[model samples]
Target: MYRVWNFINNYSLLLVAGALIALIWANFDTHAYHHFVEYPLWFNDWIGGDFTRWANNYGEGFEKFEVGDVTKVLSVHYLVNDILMAFFFAIAAKEVWEAVILKEGSLRGKKAATPLIATLGGMLGPIAIYVGLAALMGSATFDAISRGWAIPSATDIAFAYLVGRVVFGAGHPAVRFLLLLAIADDAAGLIILAIFYPSGDLAPAWLLVSLGSAVGVFVLFNWLPRMMDRGDQLRPMSSWVRKYLSFWPYLLAGCASWFGFQEAGLHPALGLLPIVPTIPHADRAFGIFSEAEQYLTDLLNQIEHMLKHPVEVVLFFFGLLNAGVEFSSIGTPTWLVLAGLMIGKPLGVTIFGWIAARPLGLGLPSGMRALDLVVVGCVAAIGFTVSLFIASVAFDGNVVLNGIHVQDAAKMGALFSFAAAAVSIVVGKLLRVEKQHG
Candidate 1:
């Protein structure tokens, strides 16, 4: 329920700056902006997008630029999205890991019941609306855009957390409720991305490599050290490992896991996930949007702290590469994404939230009225970060619907979702939410 004002500022400002720069740059010089995004940095078979994809996007000239018989090109876009972004997802996984597994974790027990159920509505409502609307336009239109149904289901944790404070105040029970819902939504979104949006053809056998690396690192670096020091009160062996070995072993495991994902044809952005649980973590979770998180000494939080600034830099590039949609690209997909977030999110959250709170014998947090669920939904509608990521994954960037570039149109919808912050404020005032503060 606590907030870290600076964490929000640092995370959001760079991303917004990059997005704004991308929008201006793209609008000003569309061809050049696209070129920069796909600018190839490395050429090799081990990592990066295929050289064929790069050559197709850029031109026949790119074919001459290839050195040797390289199979892949590590372009600027792929570096940020596929490689560096793993750290960002790893951080999210860390939070979700603690929330589900830790004793006092927020996502456990009766306290989590309503928000968990509400998260279901939050996901389903967007799908029903997005797909239903697309279906209404006819099957041809539906076939083109139906894969994006999961886009609107995302809730950008940092942005939604920021807006939730403004709408419900830092101390409001609804703010806590909103945070829990957002975390649950993110957890679901990760699963959806992995299962439904594989980056290439499946090679399920390669996943064994990832599994082996995770187990090897956990046993050697984590569980084994503790077992050797079982009866020693000083815990000398564990301390020696923590102090000397540090994150080195896990770092190696993470790289192996990432490569396994890339080879296995899964989205490599989620590649660091398998290693998250293997790392030593704190017994208690204070939630992501809190300054208290900095005080945790567990290896997981320590690694996250180390990654904080680097992840911020990664997010900036993420926005720059992904948010370059032109204004003219707006079309059916855009409207569908918007309606799914703004219209569907609220109705679904409130409906299913009421079902859980009243019918299922769960109760709303103290001082949070049933109407507050509407405002929570509205704040959650600001799905900028994860929505944009999903939009990129959900469709081929080249797909066109009635001459509208479908991917660009969808990205624009994700960009325009920032409008939900304003909508949330207006709705909050209209609903006369009683602001509570610590």
Candidate 2:
């Protein structure tokens, strides 16, 4: 019997708080709750949802303000989901970049090979079950919810890590393997979001602006200082830039990149990704997604530290905006999402992990067994955060199927993924996993 608040009361405590409040509010007073979520903050052409699109989605009752051709409205939802959420993704992208590129990076070398393969299984399994089962329900049912195939594939890194600790103890090899798989899954989820879901019509040319900003920042702020400081034991130029200019140049580049994505018809939440690698970083990271990272004295980590609190607030608002669902909304889409996560994730991870360990010649981490992969999959199945985000993107409308809103139903499934935590604990005890304290 895992407690809801207990599970959510960590780094993501605010997020879950926001979600729980949204759920209660929506269920209690559906009309008022939606009004709050979609309330307009600003009306400008520079950055917001298109006025026509917002009107169409919300069904024509929303008031539109026009200031001589201002055709966009920045709703509370857009401010969080489309704008502020970019910072959240930027931080996620930062960790992923460090984990992959920095020396002693977790995702490097043959040691990462098996977990990487398991990540693929984690992804493909969900898609196979979600889409395949929907297809079996006949073409019409499939047509309505086919876009949500990616929802179940997401592994909320924070929640999964917490559950991994509970299931295998802090020091167990499976815990590390689960973290690696979840990180890889997050990387894959980002790519899937970028490639599959476009905010509007395609405009690849605007991506050039994002790329150019990245290049310009690297040359002027990052690479130039080091080049100028070459052969100088004092390293004065780099130090000067670090102290004086600081993260300003990169921040400016991030804004430009964000606008580029907004104008490019891609999801603007991923906009800051290009600018992350442009900033200066430490040569090596202590651990991937570890607390010791806050101690590192690199501009990248410093920027992350700076944004940590603001991002937490942003995540809170994001949850409030996206997770407002009524229980009646649960239907076929809900079941499909749950089935994909609970059933497909564990089965795929166990089978494919075994193959990767035995047939492919790659092996699990020391003290981890084939059965442990099942528990890892169970932990990974708690897909609350990223799954909720993707559900919002995949079914972002009031479209009703079988007299229920599909988006809300899908989000409900994501929220229900918390149940996987209890499942993981039970599975661990059933398998008699030896707990190893760090």
Candidate 3:
């Protein structure tokens, strides 16, 4: 456990390495690595063919038999976004808490401004780019079909870190700050996810139920420490309390809230809010705990710890998903998509981030020059996972938004972002060296 934490802490910068590996596989790896093959049919069927069939019929004939509707191919994306990714949220929430609450005082000042400004820039970067696109070229049809404006806002935390560590090296504070900024950027994007792409339909009773569930989590999390201190014996209150206690229980409660919110016409992301506050982390890691207590604490700690390197895992799945795209169907080389990611993303990030940063007295990192920021901006283009995620939820299985298919556009944009960042990183490095000699 400690080794995993250390690896993530020291090598969190390797996300780009993972992303690049995934990208390579996506483009070329057919020999051994499984790929995400894009079927003209629903994406769900393409990814989880038989498993989906089983999930939809597992409970048939049982008293409370409830099977998920699997008619839509996009359901697989939801499983990743809503179910599996919730754990990502749990981890992300823990990190954000660490940055803001646990390390609040120590993390302030000029040294910390990189992560702060970078995160802000990442948030603003995508929004500015998309809105700009909307103004310049977004047709009404495109706007209606492509409802996702915030997809580009996210930074692939894992990939960015990998690039920074390998290409730039960990000794560079700027690189480290850049990685942290990526993580913060992802958090900001998650906020956008919660606010923007909520499931349609707002039911009052469901809203009330969600509220009640939230209250229960709040009460339970607050009192669990006390309950543990009091005794092991389950009280009338204890049974209810136990339901709210434990990581998995809290996760279940979060799931319930997600469903309630979905039914109530609120964003499912809100379901994560209650548990976000409760995700286990020692607010003050001052003292050690007893062996028994420490074991439980470690369990909570693991959730947050694993999230630190989500880029590797996310990139792998993204590659798998990307593999699903049928190249022959799209009359374009995947490289065209890569080109856009390479050029468009960095241009957007540098312009917006520089514009935002210049107004303030904040300066770029010591060794990082303006051109380096451009490279960093280039790295920002790797938006495959989050962009795809946004596209899936925003379009609701509607393939074409405007004239272009939403999924196609998303894949195109992501590949473009990746290419733009990769080329820029190499170019930026050369420029950095020449500047030093000059």
Q: Write the per-residue lDDT of candidate 1 for residues 1-438, one digit (tens) a residue.
A: 555736567889999999999999999998898889988899888999878777776653565573798888899989999999999999899889999999999999999999999999998998899999999999999999998999999999999988998888889999999999999999999999999999888999999999999999999999999999998999898899999999999989999999999999999999999999999987997788467877878888888888888989999999999999899999999999999999999988999999999999899999999999999999888889999999988888778999998999999988999999999999999999988876
Model 1, C-alpha of 42: deviation from truth (Å): 1.2
Q: Highest TM-score, which number?
A: 1
Instruction: Candidate 1: give the clashing pairs.
Output: none
Locate the minimum summed-lDDT window of 10 residues in model 2. Answer: 1-10
Candidate 1 TM-score, true structure as reference:
0.98
For candidate 2, the per-residue lDDT at 324 reads 93
lDDT of 3 by residue, 74-154 (tens): 333344444455555555555555555565422456655655665565556556555555555546634553365666666
Q: List runs of model 3 lying over 4 Å from the truth.
A: 1-77, 104-114, 138-141, 144-146, 203-211, 224-246, 266-270, 284-299, 305-323, 328-359, 365-367, 401-404, 433-438
Clash number for every model? 0, 0, 27
Candidate models: Cα lDDT each: 0.91, 0.87, 0.52
The candidate with the higher lDDT, 1 or 2, is 1
Per-residue alpha-carbon lDDT of candidate 2 for residues 1-438, written as tens digits (9 for 90 to 100): 111222134447999999999999999998888878877777787889887767665554575444356778788889999889999888778878987997777898888898888889988898899999999999988999999999999999888988888888878889889988988899999999999988888899999999999999999988988999999989899999999999999989999999999889899999999999999999887544456766789999888878877888888888898999998888989999998999889987888888999999899888888889999999999999899999998986767888888998999999999999999999999999999887
Compute the lDDT of residue 38 as modeled in candidate 1.
88
Instruction: Put the candidates in lDDT order, highest first.
Output: 1, 2, 3
Q: Can you give the TM-score per candidate against the true fold?
A: 0.98, 0.96, 0.67
Off by over 4 Å in 1: none
